[model samples]
Target chain A: MPNCRTVVPFSGTPEQEQKLREVIARYKGTQGPLMPILHEAQDIYGYLPEEVQATISEELDIPLAEIYGVSTFYSRFSLNPKGEVKVSVCLGTACYVKGAADVLAEVEAQLGCKAGSVTSDGKFSIDADRCVGACGLAPIMIVNGDVYGHMTVDRVAGILDSYRGEVE
Target chain B: MSENMINLKIDGVSVEVPAGSTVLQAALAAGVRIPTLCYMKDANELGSCRICVVEIKGGRGLAAACVYPAADGMEVFTNTEKVRASRRQTLELILSNHRMECPTCERNGDCELRRLAADMGIDSIRYEVEDLEPQLDESAPHLVRDNSKCILCRRCVAVCRKNQQVGVISAADRGFATHIESAFGRGLGEVSCVYCGQCVAACPTGALTLKRSIDAVRAAIDDPSKHVVVVPAPAVRVGLGDRFGMPVGESVQGKMVAALRRLGFDKVFDVDWAADVTIMEEGTELVGRIKAGEKMPMFTSCCPGWIKYMEHYHADMLDNLSSCRSPQQMMGGLVKTYYAEREGIAPEDIVVVSIMPCTAKKFEVSREEQRLENGCMPVDYSLTTRELSDMIAGAGIMFGLLPDEAFDPVLGDSTGAAVIFGASGGVMEAALRTAAVVLAGDDADVPLVFEDVRGMEGVKEAEYEVGGVKLRTCTVSGLANAEKVIRAMEAGEAAYDFIEVMACPGGCVNGAGQPMHSPFERMMTDVKGERAAGLYALDDSMPRRRSHENPEVKALYAEYLGEPCGHKAHHILHTEYVPRDTYNV
Candidate 1:
């Protein structure tokens, strides 16, 4: 009964499709190619849509169920498109013990979007990562590529305000 | 012992098994019991569920008996203190997350997990299940999926991908969120699921089960205005007895008829009669196609699973399929049309229910093409063998002691060719038996038995010269074998004049709607072979061995329909197909 929490509309362009097909053709015959092809497709499309999964299923002759299974198994692969400003809160053991869940909750309230989904305006997204390997900076939050160590609930809105003004 | 045998000591008993055998196999060889939850012989061996964990001497911890190989001088202890605790702990953890509604579960009495828990004497669950919110999926016509009862064994997934080769269902997501689902969380009906129900059969718990029609059938029977007529498919005759405490491979045709009569049906008939009629129409079509050289191979359309698979996967070769309705649908159409007229009952007033060994028949009965011109389906309710057995038990009818009763004379009589339609090569063999005589002009010598296409092999191929016509034929059970044949034909490596495909292994006798057996019994016993043998035995006992020889079928053709494949017969007994997308959602 596990289902997709949020599914963004598939907006892959013709150029992106052509690039995906090329990537599929390059790795069609390689042993265990679904993983590599999925990774590349995710990179090209920013996320794996049902339409993109169907294309891969047809080109590789693999069942779409299997492709979807592999895509969902790895946390690296995203099913929904990431927003322009991606916010990731590490919920690994170290981060959780130091109150990362509060940070994640604040982000969700500020962005008006749940974890693993984009905001209504498609400008902000939040995800709970397992571990970012920064235990020394427990309770860490990453915005785009920039990491904030020892993050607090009160500081979450201030950091988002700084990016909100820049994006608008 | 053979040179390749491995020496092992299981529970202090010296056992010698094949080198490639696992610790479970070695223990079984030495008469040791090792309970398993996620192990289905030749189908699933994930060892994900550690219910089969056993202690090995000189090893650090308990190892899974299903995957742990038996080596020379290996000491395997199946029931040691450590093994017992580990298995008990594993079961407890699985049960912690699993929905414990055994009283109302479909597989209450036959559940493997429940049986194991009782055997291990686990009275209570220590941990509470975090709200998983496992949803019930009743999207498909044939199967219902309840993730609440799923133990994440993946047996259904393995069987779907490996045994059936359909691969419609798979384990999506990971960890606690992992659940079996179709692509993109689409419903099974929304996807290209053929509704074969093999996954239902592979499920160890109440996670998967056929969509029941027992209540609808009961309602139709209770309505005084309606006249309900029941027709059981050929395979049900041989497979239904398995639920009645009868021995496996026992054909209780008379008892089945008696039970249906006791179930308040207005008439109890046999689908085998319609199977004979199918041979007449399909045989004529096959001969015409061969004579005109229209298509290379004419695939049989009796199996709804195979039909849907063709429609989904091999739509381009749809023309290659014989347009004849399956025996069940043929019988239903005839009951609503010919029998209804004969009895002076309106087609709308008469309810046609098919008792089948297949779950796919439920979907088949709901098809738009199967509906009459009056906008009513020929078959009202298609009930599985298991459903019928449950209804019989629920009605307080002692099936074992019921007197053997013959089917009503209206649509009861059939020939030997009709009975064998339960097996894999049955339809092909039945067609050949009649086609030989049709091509050679009836009174000419023809072979009654086509031994080449008989037995329980996944795929069988044969070449025969009938009436100076050299015909290459292929008979396949299991969609995987069908896929292989199609791929071979596409590659120009193989050619055939006729092909018969049954999606279930060993044909309808091993259908998903038939009796459920434990993994041990399934691995040890040849259920498919035994059930098919029962049909073949019944076929051998019949005096008339061919379809054309069925007196009732010939009487119908002479009385109403002018001839086989005639315009009127075509209107009722034939149908068309359309291509379907695999991912319709």
Candidate 2:
């Protein structure tokens, strides 16, 4: 029954602390407002780390368990930090039937990381996804939210190269 | 009839529909069927199919009529030249990498893709079909996955991850070669999947299908040396009628039993009998633990999906699960051991077949630990509701002409309470029926119905003051809700004296192994709810609705077993869950 203030202590720059306070004020005394605040914070900061979750929990006077529950419940929210470039591979049924496995393998090899893992250099974060509904363009990959259609194993390196030059 | 309505023009025809209706609804009201593949009503509206695209005047581009809202003064064209071309092209693109073996496919005539192509008059593919070899994943016992015919509509993924809350398979790679795969490309059997088969129900194509056990059952029947016995699950009575084009919730128990007899089975029994026995065993276990103050929250073990979830993710809590095998498994064990001895048949010669409403029953039948005597698996084959329907049709039996008959006297009699086990919260209610009687010491007939734990809510809870002792109980349907309940319990946010969990929402009636329906079509009717009502109504009409009233179950105790928790009953009807870390990723 302990509140979020008991779980998280105040630890951030004065400006960052003020920004957290402003975010908390927007959702103060509102029903189920923690999810929306977390969403907005993740939208601004690219991810919801433990520190950020704790800060939000303390500011909103909610339990950290409740905050963690909200984050894990929804598919849109992610806990880990995302790299500058987000690489998402399509694993929709159509693409899977068409050989998305090869595309995934090639991308994993080139990036030197598995799906749902971020690159050591912090340049790219790779992840596989459910259908984005572009089955007509089977074996599709999306990098930084830009859809790449009809991808092949040979074409994955080029797609990664294009993102490498542009990202960071 | 004085409600306000909206008038809209679709494909040059004027139609009137409700104000909040979508353009798809408006068009349907005009008798204009807009072609669609991935727009199953409220179940799936991801608009991933792109086949329902219709040209809307003043709109940016072709819009999916299913999800796009209908506004006043809007002009909609259902089958414009551009619309037809776009739909045809989209289908052609889907076919480019698809395996076109429609003649031999299971869903040959009933397939949505084939029907759409025929409706669109697509005779040949314009693009070169990719040479991506098809993958036939037979790792799971109850379901088969063929990725070649997949269109990636993601209806299956949406239902599994969002609706069922079991993330077994997901979209894995990006563009042109994108495919749905199990986590880390591991076999589905290795994952924490409940095997609820919601993905099978959500799939629009033949990619996901119930693994038919008909051949194995048929082989058993044909073998003169084997005595094949059949046990029909509680939900099968209500669902089997749908295969005969009967209205949702029709009780076809008589027909099902008669059909099994005609199919050359030596004996046709009811899982309901074992369900009663399960209540006896599980109910006693609950009381013993409660009396001894051991394992405060005893979870129901009838649901194979929930058991698999515990085995994979929550292995540490395995001891908390009720040690009763599902009614299907219980029936199988009894038929092979007790019945085999009584009938003078060798244990190996007695083949037990279960006709179930779930796909997960297949996994339960073949579980390594399920073998009872001399390493012999109790249930030989588990046929899904759909597979059973196919077998009935394959035998050329005139179902409509068949008279409704009763199940055999031995193990065939069941109570109305046992029948409700097909739907969500059923196990909890069934257990409560016997628990109340046992707690009263001489069976209290008062308060037969536990209304709090009934309904379609994801999670439900109630406190029962039975015999002056407060018992906190919780029931969760759907794996996601179960996860929430477990997390709450682990975090000390919630406490329950007992819990019942089913992986599929609405229980076996809405199982993954049931028939697949378009979401748009389901939006037009309350199919799942109606099916559930059918089971509940059947329960109400039965004269023997309490588990303890089952004469066969009483005989089970008198003949073979001394008491519910007797050593003999525990050896056969009960088992344990094992922890596994098979998530390769």
How do the candidates score on chain B by TM-score?
A: 0.98, 0.93
The DockQ of each candidate is 0.55, 0.04
In angstroms, give how far residue B383 of model 1 lies from its true place: 0.6
Model 2 TM-score on chain A: 0.69
Kindly report the root-mean-square deviation of model 1 from the true structure over all alpha carbons.
Answer: 2.3
The best candidate by TM-score is: 1
- Model 2 Cα shift for residue B315 (angstroms): 2.1
The CAPRI category of model 1 is medium
In DockQ terms, which candidate is top? 1
lDDT tens per residue, model 2, B83-188: 9899989999988877878888887746888888888999988998887676888887767788998888878777776665555666654465466766334566
Supply fnat for every model shown: 0.69, 0.00
Query: Which consecutive 10 residues in model 2 chain B have the weakest lDDT in total?
Result: B576-585
